[model samples]
Target: MSSAAATLKQQKEDFVSNLSGGPVGEIHAVAFVAPVAVLLWSVLQSRQSFFQRYGLLAFTVDYFLNVVAILLAKTLYSDFPLLLSLLLAVPATLVYVLPPNAVSPKRKPKVPPSADSKNKLDPLPLKPFLTSYRSFMLISTIIAILAVDFRLFPRRFAKVETWGTSLMDLGVGSFVFSAGVVAARPVLKERAEGRSMPWIRRILGSLRHSIPLLVLGIIRLLSVKGLDYAEHVSEYGVHWNFFFTLGLLPPFVAASQAALAFVPSHAALALLISGSYQMLLETTDLKAYILTAPRVDLISMNREGIYSFIGYLAIFLAGQDLGMFVIPRKLNPRSNSSAGVQRNTLIMTLAVWTGVWCGLYALSTNYKYGFALVVSRRLANLPYMLWVAAFNSALVLALCVIDSIFFPAFYNAADPKSEKEAYLTATSRILRAYNRNGLALFLLANLLTGFVNMTMNTLEANPLVTVVILVAYTLAVTSAAVLLDSYNISIRV
Candidate 1:
């Protein structure tokens, strides 16, 4: 071949190579578009139908697993632990959306039902939830330990390069789990009890109830000194955006309901919005810019922007479906049932799905251009989006099944005037407390983690001592939370 012809060929190869993270790469852009395409089709076609009618849960599980894939696509996407946050939201959303709105006729006559059950009683013995949650926690912890200590699991399986960041990720999970439980109370209560209040009243009520705590969280997040504290710790440690966003979510739910009354078929709209936004971000050359200067712009990277909103919107729509149509009208036991078989099934299903996620991540990373973020206006990647969707759904399904086994009371908290009523009522209060102080708690959690690390680093102690001290601090915080109110929020210690 002539020298000019050879140079042209080399340039073509290099172009392909850069796109695929290789010297001579082959990336199919269609692979990235398929999920969004299918999702759009599913939503548009299924507007009049229920989410369950088309196995939406299964789809959601796949979507969430794909999100984990998105996470592993590159090192840059790892900072935002969106998968874990959404996972924690699953059980809480169910608790909010699924239960009867009317007082259960099952209540005994002598019990007036006026007393607040929350302060006086323990949550009904949902041995399944406690068991499942504890088991999952223990397993996760063990997985983390093994990943850290023995290197027994594959980097593909249990590998995590960043430890401090991962621990903070766990902290976010704990806070989200606890806070969602708390928020579900009044939201669920209003649903079941048949609220006479106007839509505006409901919105205002939620704002009034939550505003104080929200303000406190905002104060912490916006503080100059707090950013200084964040600088001392990990770069992502000073995330106040979650607080502000979470503070807005309940009201957003309320507003969404109001909109539903007007639009009758808003879920389809949400799906379209999410998918279109995703597509725009991917096809455009915007990601290159976002990745270059993430800190400066809100939508530069995944700092709780439209991409995150799309996931949350999908979740909200799902919640609405379950709330309005699914939960109150019980399905077959198969929909619930937390027996050993069911639990094992969920675990295995999640494991398989997680494996699929890992595979996708590996593939997508090796060939980045093959998949793009659905939202071209934003900096989302296909793997990150898929991972969050799949992981979130798996967490939701697992929690629901587990809740079914141990917390049967959740299935039917009908009575407002019995010992059982009191028990169920307390669970609501626990929900309330978490919702009330969620932002504060999250901010506090970061501060606590950062300050510990800062102190340990300054001391320059032995590595073993640092680990021990950090663990001790974690235990102390957890113990205090439990001692304050064992069942009020999660006692993760």
Candidate 2:
């Protein structure tokens, strides 16, 4: 095989290894932690300037992607090698095999720095970790959904199923991620004009825009059959609890911003509060009170009784925090050779993470074998959290490494002009030319999942048929998401 093909194979192997935790979760933790250690070393050395420039972002992305990949794994079949290979391959091919010139870095033209230094400033130092929190929960909830589905129909759907939760997760994740991009655009533009919104005001301003989108989504959801009124409500559609959970996010995020005025370590506080709150809920009498009975509104109907409000609220604050870091500013572009070394180093780093992940999965198999885990429910509590954290950390690590290595090339090819301009131009085109409307796309996916649930509700099919149907439904939803994204982009322009 060619070097690219070999590299691709190696990456896939690593991804699977990390994913499976074959006999125990140790390999999983090792898969991620080891590379992190190495990257830390590289960063400390400062031998590779590219590594230094991107180390923070790389680490952040790594954790984010780890959640994504693991979540995908839960939803995919036990015999996932084929599909998994393809999923990684498609993106990997575009990133790794594509000709250099086709996606080469654009010539760095000397553009004047924006007048407002604040607007032109790089991401806030504290933001990336906060973003990592958002990513983890978003990923975790999706993974949790898959685990729940697998338990419901283990043999029939080898992988976890995504049904009711898809409404919230897809809707919320897309919106937040998109909103971050959206909020950043104007902030950068204002910088170019030499005016910077005070951080506090900026947070409030973002809330103003984001909260409305959340509210609008709720309104749109309510106008439909809704959870309580609909037949087969359990099978698909947005559950009542999601609306409640999501409804609370914006205000809660706004509150966090307010807290920042008094709290010096706002990010740390957010993390502590979120994690501790979750832990307390698990330990306290609240668990019995909340879980014993289900909440019955359109928003709360589909979920387990406990509010998890704090959990989701924490996620929102985390998102805000992350937004701080990811809002990129102008940095001196690296020389060509430096860029290449960065690219190669990224590839190597990904390889390391992948290997570690596989090793962890292999080790995890010895401990216990279950379809998926919910952090709160299991007897092996700390282990479960550790398991998830390890898996997620590695996944995010790999994603960051890949994005870091490939983003410049990818970014350049996407737009030939300024990074900010390119993002705006590209996103604007996406918003205009495609249905980048996440809510609409997710709604359709939920609709299809509902239809699948409706049809299969009574069927006593063989395992093969069940698997086929589940896979079909999954593919359908994924396709719809992509199409909707396209449509959202198309129309926005």
Candidate 3:
């Protein structure tokens, strides 16, 4: 190697060594506290006009905090206790510094509805999209994190057997589950409005809608195979990629929905079946067969591409059920009258779900027969599904809480219209940008990852340099998503 190349390589090695231990753990700790910080900022800054005039500025501040946190992890505080304390202190201090709204409530002005209002369906609400946006952003962040935290940085901090790895695996399931939920919502709503379809017809209809995704997956798979990209066989399989999972899983999910339509507690039933399957795998030699099968046919039968899809399907169904439960059944104009009631109901439901999550987590942890929670992305086991569901529910709940507390103030200041009208427009454009073109963003990220890997020596890059690269990659993808959304172009299946 040349003199400059050798120096760069040494720097990379030294940075990787540091990142492998305390720095990486601190980064994870910071990540765990980020949502809280953002929430606190939103609540405390409710009266500020800065967010109203420059919504992108708000997002920028949030992103900047995250970057700073990463830097802090690398430099100032490598210990979890100190880092976490600082994270907690910032939000706690803000709460005391920022006073609650002291302005008197404004009187509502009622407007007589036009004749056309009676015939029109109310606009689709933005609240549901809040969860959708958060999920999409999370998936994007995870993809970025994987590029740096797993691929570029040292492997010691991102070990495959660790809880962090397990959480990332759960995130994969959560991302797909959220997609399934959003896709199923319109169908469920139509059914609720007495436009029900036959189960087989519904299944087939879903498959039809998924045709585009299937085609894209095929194209991607062929491209990867032809290009001979670095394949993570252990992650999925020789022929299976994330895109393939996204494409193929929908049909099975639809089939599950159709088959289980008669069951009142279908989500619970799916969860039960997943647990039983995991138990069977644990007790028998089936896991070995699935993991070590020599032939492609046999391997596909057990790989994350196929059999593990069963658990993912279950997770999807559960997400659909949760979506149905959370979203309002009717979007009639009068539904706005009960917005507070609806918010309270969602909060209550979230609490109940949290209880369920805690119970399951405790049971899984306490079980003595080796039936403990085993989070295996390759297997998509029961515990993993539960964790994903639970975490997602909590996240949605947090967003809703933030919305209930601060969004109204922001909305009122930003718009002159009624609260109901303003609520619909409260969603940030940045979020809408990602939510509208999430698939495109994911595809773009993958393309960028490949491009960057080819152009730069990612595995031998300095940790700080890798972070900068990841941020740049994120910005490029996000900008594309935002720009596409601005043009009203959504790359949907």
Candidate 4:
């Protein structure tokens, strides 16, 4: 073979190798976590003397088996090895272990119904805003650290085409969406109250919630610019930074929400508009211009930055829509019948979302519309949006299932009379810690990443050593968040 052919073959091999941790790969990992967590929860609930006597050993053995499975799969297979492992392990555990011990009489909690119970259809309570916020932060924090310090997997894992990249993209979109949901509540309330505010006033009002974000963004931009920090050119443009995106996002989100008042399904409208713009770029030379333009021109035009912001805005709008759907309009106690109805609604919603996700995935697979068909965070095309929505909906659905099965007592635990409920609150400690100081944790991770780079040769580190370091870094950040939470010092904005 010629040299060119050899190089092409090498690149192809590398790409295939990278598939060890791609989308299917991630699904496999997620698949493993979900079942394992459920199984463990079930065992704990059983409180079986045999299990309690050897529960630690069982957990250790199970975890070891999983790690071995992952390593073997990573070494031997290029595609969906994790999925295969999950397939083998989850069914075995479910059939042989979880089924018999799924429920325990000792674990059941009995509580009186609410006195104010009225309707038979109780609304599902709104998920905490910080759940999404902390989730996004945690994922992004890990990815950001991995990118700079010890890459646990192949470089392709971090490439724009990979599932890991998509995860980060979802994180960003979710964060923006969470904020948009919070900001829109008052605006929605005011509108509902028959208070008519001018469009400009509404926009400004929406932006006020972003003041802390704007300030942080500006500070980060200045620090990065002044210090000549190592930059990921493809993440933003050559001259643009993430802070600029954050700073610009509020106004766009505000504008989009304002438009929502006029256009039903405004999030969908934004998606359509952004998707069209991305298609136009794909079909013409405009994309080339933005990507390859001179720095002066790029900075002045804000070409990629502007387009990406539009995509982000669409994602934020979608998040807002999702928030409105999931969060209850009011928090009132209801009868068991009402709670059952809410649970059924959630199940139905999850089913619908699953179908939607399958359809979108199939469409993207079958149809080729150039770059529009591909998932690109920079472009924020239709496929990417669909993927984000699908993934998030699936996550929420999974949480709902977990809540219903393993920890039903935790729901509405705040009722003073419901003292027999589980000790676990709706918000777990780790989640609460991270949520209370998400921005602080993010900033802390960035600073620590920079420090590590300065102090050690991260690129040259052993992969195992890198993994250890990342674990330490994660623990350190988590500890800080927990400490802050203990003090009730939440660093918002």
Candidate 5:
């Protein structure tokens, strides 16, 4: 490479490195744990016509809640997480406290004609909380991936070098966990219904499903090297990335499918695997080798990624366990499908997730003393897995509480067609859209991130410039996704 090009590349890498990791990711997590619930409760507490669903303001609010909230939290309010959450949530609270018709519905009411089948919106249960939460994780991850490269994002929210919880550190695990949850639709449902399947067939099926991911991983590895991108080797190591890690997990999950029946619980399997992995890390020279070994060979070159596979697998399995718990008892015998989360299941889900979150929190903090093993994204260690489980459960727990407060039924037979009533159910519209083809959206975001990086020098940009670029980037992304959703076009592989 030319001297000037090399110099620019080095400067770019350094500029971004100095901008990452601290308590901000954790603080943001704490701040957001309850606001989504608070917002829903506020909106549902009464017949408030002022804040009509799908109204421009409502869309703005919902859009921010799902797409923009974390972006801004990690950027403008990184230091004032609690305040920002309140700032976003207080309006929702106010909407509830306000009297009905407080803000008059602006649109004229249209009388409903005789029953029209085509215009009907089916009860949108489609695993409401699960899909919505997954979308939230995906959205946050996509936004942060690009934002972290800019000076606008808080350094504190970047991936930590070692053991600690940061927004970026949470991204990989959370993505894997969410993928695992959805990926388990058939596996869990079959288990629930007491069906038998050949273990080899199941493993082969998983391999087939994994082809696209494996291909994508290869593409990413080649593209990064081909372009001579600035890579932080300590994160995933040479030749390994998040894609490969995610891609390899399914086969393992499938291979263990038959063994799942023998195990008392999926959680037990997860614990067994992760616990054993941790033991390997501690009892042998494995941990030191992974962290400190020379990168003379391929295995050593990608020690972080290769070794961390066990940890990611555990996270994925835990997600599947959660999925098994949340899915409706009535499985679709013809296909692996997740519909509306059964209302009857919410109570137990709420309790279990709440308890898990609290238990994990207590254990991780050692009763406020400090983490026994600080969360290490690099190692994907026990603490890291536990943290992912805890945070995701907490997020889901919040959504469950929202569901309990808002929906009288988990899946409504039909939704109100009126524009005003649509607002009430419109909350999940964008989220559902993103969830439909989440991998596509992530891929698009990566491409866009690459384009932006190549086109401009993000590190030297002022905060305002950075914010504007981010907003534009997000708007472009959401708009495309929404457009595709509106057209019923899902780019699913």
Candidate 6:
């Protein structure tokens, strides 16, 4: 490389490394969830005829405001995330729940049919929240992957150097966890219905399914070195990358699917495996080897990725267990469940969230220890696992509330054989698009990240310029999936 180019690459590398990250508090993470909640509320509760006539324009505005605007605002206006949440939430709550003051008394407005009236309609055996969760993770990740290089993105929100919580750190873990949730969906349902696939079949199928990821991992490794990309060596060690971690994980998770007969429960198995791994980190030399060892050989070079895999595996397992609650059970079309069952599910979710937080508190606080174990995304340690679970489950529970309120029939039963769903608004349409074509969308974003980096000096861009580029890049990424979904395209691999 030329001296100037090499120096520029080094400067870019220094920008992202050694970030301390923001404080670990619920208040800040609220920035991430609030806009989404409001967006879904706004779009889903809109009258259907209004959407059919102006759907495209409405979706464009809502998507820009909620998804794109929130993405930029969270970083640019980092000081008052809670305020931002309320700004959107207060208006959304009022608009969705309250009667408009302008209407005359003679004309009665329409409200959704009461749940009592829909007693016979079965809830569609679909989990829109699960899709939304995955899309959120993916969207945050795609935004961060490029946004991190720019000055507009806050350093405090970037991944930490060694051990601490950060939005980017959670983003990675959430991606893995979300992947686990979706991957195990079909198998979990089949097993619940007593048609669990044979162990050998699952292992083989998963491995086959994972080939594209592994290949993409290889391509990423080659491209970084070949292009002399600005890489933070400590993030995943000298040679390892996240794609490799993601690619290698499925077989292990698939094996767990078969081992369910022997293991007591998915949650127990997740905790057991992760706890055992944590013990090894505490007792043996593995932790040191991962943290401080010289990068002389391949294993030492990629120690971070190799050692972190076990923790991620545990996380994926936990997601599978969580999926049992979040993903709807496939009921016979004739089966009619009461609205009470929906309330029961919500109650159970709150209970689960409570337990998750309590476990997280116990681990993080250790009951007045003054200093608890810091979360280590690099090591993917126990505290990190709990933190991921706590963050994700909390969001899931919140989304469930929104889904119940506006999309009440979401948890309603319907014929599994019927048309999947009929979402009216653009935001839901686009989110489902992203979910259907997740991996492809991610790969496209990575490619776009590379292209944008190579073409422009991201480290030097002004705030307005940064936003412009990010918006264009985001539009390109989102539009591709939306366009594909418009044509009935779904790319699995």
Q: Rate the local accuracy (lDDT) of all candidates.
A: 0.37, 0.38, 0.56, 0.53, 0.71, 0.71
Clashes found in each candidate (C-alpha, N, C closer than 3 A): 34, 65, 0, 0, 4, 6
lDDT of 4: 0.53
Candidate 2 lDDT by residue in tens digits, 20-52: 112223223322332233233223222222222
Show the lowest summed lDDT stretch of 10 residues, model 4: 69-78
Span of ten consecutive residues with least summed lDDT in model 3: 15-24
lDDT of 2 at 304: 40
Clash tally for model 2? 65
Candidate 6 colliding pairs: 122-412, 122-413, 122-414, 123-412, 123-413, 123-414
Residue 406 alpha-carbon offset, candidate 3, angstroms: 1.6
The residue-level lDDT of candidate 1 at 133 comes to: 30
Model 3 alpha-carbon drift over 4 Å, by segment: 1-31, 55-59, 62-124, 128-142, 145-165, 296-302, 329-338, 408-421, 424-426
**Candidate ordering by TM-score (highest first):** 6, 5, 3, 4, 2, 1
lDDT of 1: 0.37
Q: Of the candidates numbered 3 and 4, which has the greater lDDT value?
A: 3
lDDT of 4 by residue, 1-493 (tens): 5675455444433432332224643633532343344333333443332233224564344333323333333222224545555655565455545345433446433333543243332233334332533343354434444443333444443335322343345555555655554545555556447797777886787576567666776676677666555445555665565656666766666665556656787456656666676677678986676566666765535666666776677666766665554555332233344545665675677668657765764576455642326566666666666666666666566655655564455343444333223422233445546656766787787788767755765655786776667656655776687679667686755
| Residue pairs with backbone overlap in model 5 | 19-155, 20-155, 53-423, 127-339
Q: Name the best candidate (by TM-score).
A: 6
| TM-score of every model versus the real structure | 0.48, 0.49, 0.78, 0.72, 0.85, 0.88
Q: After superposition, which runs of candidate 5 have C-alpha atoms over 4 Å from their true positions? A: 15-20, 28-59, 100-125, 191-194, 329-345, 364-371, 409-426
Q: Which stretches of candidate 1 lie over 4 Å from their true place?
A: 1-188, 196-199, 222-227, 232-240, 262-270, 283-289, 293-386, 399-444, 458-463, 486-493
Model with the higher TM-score, candidate 2 or 4? 4
Residue 5 lDDT (model 2): 44
lDDT of 6 by residue, 204-226 (tens): 88887678888988899999999
* Residue 233's lDDT in candidate 3: 56
TM accuracy, model 4:
0.72
TM-score of 1: 0.48
lDDT per residue as tens, model 5, 1-493: 8897788788766655532356635654533733463355337433364224456775565566667776777788776777767775777777766665443455533323633335444322245566668877888888888998987787767777766777777777888888777866786556557887788887887887688988999999999999988777878888998888888888899886666678886777888898899888879999999889999999999999999999999999888777766654332334434334445455566577758755764575574574566667889998888878777776777775565565443344444344224333434566767887888999999999999988887887898998889988988888778788767788965
